[model samples]
Target: MDIEYIKDNYIFEKLNENHNLDDFECEIEDLAKFLKEDAWNQQNMNLSLTHVVICDGIVVGYVSILTDAMKLRILEDKETKDKICSKLNISENNVIPAIKIGRFAIDKRYAHNGLGKHVFRNVMLSILDISENIVGLRFITVDAYATAFGFYVEKHKFKYLKKDQKDVDSLNKIIKIDPERSFSLYKDIKSILK
Candidate 1:
């Protein structure tokens, strides 16, 4: 089966009071907790907005997004910074604006299936549309968890801005347990258009 057919069985919407979020469980406890708890709180606070993917009137997965900025000077890879500047038509030392996926999770029942990718494809499309029309977004960033690092980098082509840098989205606080892992990654929105 292809991703389209799998995606066709699901419906995507912004998180709302009408959502059936009681039984939404993923492998990660924090992710599951966020969906049922922090998602609404964060949304109401204007900190982040969650997008849910539902099937059979039940929430299957979700991704929360928030605005972020990537500092070119902080990136370790000079080549990547140069490419970003050249592609976005900006200076190498400028801070580029971006959208960040603050959290992403798939329900346990939906895990190991292709629904995550399906949901991600739609996200890319939505962000791409927004960037082209409503806003001039240059990148889609994510502070991906250490466990799912390979999936984002290999499957979605998200690249690390710097291997040694701490997670910037943590807002000046340190929550990371592993200093060796660089989970802050980004995908150029322009690259998706191409």
Candidate 2:
């Protein structure tokens, strides 16, 4: 688990038909299952695009991303909404283009090193490139697990999406599976605007 070695050696490659994911495990069952079983199928379905960090023909980490749009009105936390408005210089009643990190996980073996943060930086960098060239995306969103709260919020500056009652459907579905689910969280791209 040499962080510098990984940084110098690992390459981000699009998940493809030839890749064998049998040994990829992040110790989080759901995340591992999603990568090994669902990622390719979902990619074929145009649901999400997955990328793997490979080093010496092994998968060290992976992330799945997809297009997302956030309706500003759903940001019920007044302070959060106001901050977003002031930073992006926009009203709080329109749709803001975004990209969602559908899934993000690092291998269990790479847990304690700086690899997770390194991989996340790659994610943001890739999104920034896309934002500059392909689209004018304004935000980044994630359905963060409770265990990931500190990682997304404190470490990465993500804030909870404080939607009103109208956000019940998605909340309910997540809550049904894990009662401690954190619902949704977002990072304003304006903070890192190019």
Give the RMSD in angstroms, all C-alphas superposed, for model 1.
5.1
Q: Give, for candidate 1, the lowest lDDT window spanning 10 residues.
A: 171-180
On the 0 to 100 scale, the lDDT of residue 89 in model 2 is: 88
Q: Against the hidden true structure, what lDDT does model 1 obtain?
A: 0.79
Q: Can you tell me which runs of candidate 2 are displaced by over 4 Å?
A: 76-80, 83-90, 163-182
Q: Could you give candidate 2's per-residue lDDT for residues 1-194 as a string of tens digits?
A: 57788878998899998888988887568888999999999999999999998988889999999999998877745776788788878898878899999999998988767788878977888888889899999788998776666687767877776552344445555545664565587877766433
The deviation in Å at residue 166 for candidate 2 is: 17
List, residue by residue over 1-194, the lDDT tens digit for candidate 1: 34455478877789999998988897778889988989999999999999898776778789899999888866666777788778778887688889998988888877777788778888888999988889787788887766677678778887776653555455224435653333688887877755
lDDT (0-100) at residue 92 of candidate 1?
A: 70
TM-score of 1: 0.83
Query: For all the candidates, what are their Cα RMSDs to the real structure?
Result: 5.1, 4.5
Local distance difference test scores for all models: 0.79, 0.81
Best TM-score among the predictions, by candidate number = 2
Clashes of each: 0, 0
> TM-scores across all candidates?
0.83, 0.84
